[model samples]
Target: MSNDAVTPGETRFYQGEGQTQPLFRIEPGINCQFAREQASELMGYAQDLVLDGLLERKHNMIWAAHYLNALAKALLDDAELGLAKAKAL
Candidate 1:
C-alpha cells in the first residue's frame, strides 16, 4: 500500500534567523496495533538526543507530536480491522 494518504507533511517549529536547523522526518509506517508502541520508543530516543545535545528542543517537540499521531492512527486501523472481522462473522 502506498504511504501517500497516510504520510504527514514534514514540519518545523520555531522560526526566524536562528531557526534554520534541519528537522528530522520521523514518519512511522504503522499498520498494526502492536506497532503502535513505537511512539514511546521514539520519544525516548528524542529525549536522549536532546539531552545529549544532538537535537534541538523545538525539533524534539515536533517529532514527539508526529510519534503520537502515528500511535493514534494505529489505534484507528486496529478498530477498523476489528469491525471488518465482526462483519465477516
Candidate 2:
C-alpha cells in the first residue's frame, strides 16, 4: 500500500485462502503513538523496578525485565519503520 494513501484509521488484515478467521488491524496514528509512548514509559518503570531491588519482590524483576526487553525490541522496530517512512517521503 502507498504510504500517503493509507488512511489514518483504516484496519487491514491478512488471511489465508479458504480461511474464515478474522484478522487483527494494526493501530494507527495517535492511538499507535500513545501505545508506543506507554510502552516506553513501562520500560522506564521496569528499569526502576530492577534498580530499586524490587526484582526480588514477587518476581516483579523478571516480569519487568521481560517487558523491558520486549519493549526495547518493539521500539527499535518502530524506529526503523519510521526511518523508512521518512526516507520514502
Which has the greatest TM-score?
A: 2
**Model 2 C-alpha lDDT per residue in residues 1-89, reported as the tens digit of each score:** 23332224333343556766535433444234454566678778777777665635657676667656565445544444554454577
Write model 1 residue lDDT over 1-89, tens digit each, in one string.
Answer: 22222322232233235776733332433333333345445556655655555455466666555555554444445434443444555
lDDT of 1: 0.44
Q: Give the distance in Å from residue 35's predicted Cα in candidate 2 to where it truly belongs.
A: 6.6
Candidate 1: segments with Cα more than 4 A from true spot: 1-57
* Candidate achieving the largest lDDT: 2
Candidate 2 lDDT score relative to the true structure: 0.52
TM-score of each: 0.37, 0.44
Question: For model 2, which pairs clash?
Answer: none
Question: Any residue pairs clashing in model 1, and if so which?
Answer: none
Reference-based lDDT, each prediction: 0.44, 0.52
